[model samples]
Target: MVSSDDTYLSMRGGVSRGIRRMGGEEIYKESQDCRILNALSIGDVVVTSAGNLPANKIFHGTVIDWQLELFPSKKIIQKVVHDCLIKANHYGYKTIVFPLLGTGAGCLNKQIAWEIMLKQIIMDLSTIHQTLIEVVITLYGRETLSDLNWKFFINEMQAKWEIK
Candidate 1:
């Protein structure tokens, strides 16, 4: 799973800690150094290797800066999601997984975050012609984001996409 962050050096909190566990300390360090040259602001993304994980790459998106805002704006989240998908397509990655961004330490409303994410994903997918890219939306760890109501989200997405 990819961790979301601001343009800061410290990699604390849930997702960042997960990255550290997955041997992504090097990637995090590199990202920090890269950020000095190219700082990651809201709606910006930074792609990195998944380290020892099964995924081919990790797309670190800067959705919110806790220091600046209490929660991320829906527009910013949508843009970040779009950017991540574009980056994934550019890298020829057919499959990608995303956590419920802006919900953990960013303290965004779970329902609102899910709605924005699903809407942006559906919109982005509709623009693609015949590409078979698989986008996976995961909770990362259920314990960490217990407030996220997945059942409601799945039902909403199914209704939106008319999925059987």
Candidate 2:
């Protein structure tokens, strides 16, 4: 199933938005031949050797770069998310997983990031092969989940898709 990682949240008093750390293990690339590869980027393509992974193709999507804004403008985030979906569709991927964009050192507010993400997903749903493609958001920390705004954003997003 598509899911996010559990994160440890540090809270002080009643306020949110504090330090966060790893709370779960990552899924190793599976050992099965991939049916397709989709690179979602407007820049150079990159490839790395994974000695034992089963997937034959690896897609390098330059969704974010350090030269770019750490907390990119909302429009850019939306564009990149849309681009990822389009590229996946272009390559006929039926299932895809994405980490929360711009939440790392990028330091964008989680609520804003999620809002843009959901908007892009909703826009793409009616256009792509909706039944075949699945989008998964991987959360890397539990502490990050304390944002009530983000929780509300997720609820609204799920409401739009009836996809709880």
Candidate 3:
């Protein structure tokens, strides 16, 4: 929703933009209904129909409280990661793709966010299969991988976690 008024939404998020690029526009609308949006709160994780996305269910986790602070904290990041992992494991999901939460929408500092999110994920998942799960850390951007230290991130992921 865009606003001609001063307070109207000015832009769509990266995730929504990517989804739209993938031909999930209708599903995007379905996922953005008042109920789903309203039910989600900071630190809360909720599951909704995947709609047109490839997955069957999408777990929406709230790590940033736009009302509370300028950036998200380690605890908030950890909480959402832990909760989402538990929920995904409960559903017996073998694969979960986690976008580096709080790193977007003018939120957390990227380096610190990466550390906290990765540590929590590795520590928690270790108790599960190592876990036998494929974790995808999505960093969506308009630039190419050469623009960022993609190799460093990949090395960190491999060195820190025994990803399946």
**For this target, which candidate reaches the highest lDDT against the unseen true structure?**
1
lDDT of each: 0.73, 0.46, 0.58
Candidate 3: C-alpha lDDT: 0.58
Model number with the top TM-score: 1
Model 1 Cα shift for residue 154 (angstroms): 6.4
lDDT per residue for candidate 2 within 1-164, as digits (tens), equals 21111111111111111211111111122111111243223222222222333422233223334433233457656665665566556666676565565555456677777777777787788775654357766566674556537667768768877995
On the 0 to 100 scale, the lDDT of residue 65 in model 3 is 50
Which portions of model 1 miss their true places by more than 4 Å? 129-132, 143-164
> Residue 107 lDDT in model 1?
82
Question: 83 in model 2: Cα distance from truth in Å?
Answer: 1.2
For each of the candidates, the C-alpha root-mean-square deviation to the true structure, in angstroms, is 3.0, 10.2, 6.3
1-164 per-residue lDDT for model 3 (tens digits): 10000011111565544544463555445445633456545666655566556776666565545555534578867887888778777877777777667666646666666677777877888775443366666665653345556578778788766554
Q: Which stretches of candidate 2 lie over 4 Å from their true place?
A: 1-70, 128-132, 143-151, 154-164
- Best first by TM-score, ranked: 1, 3, 2
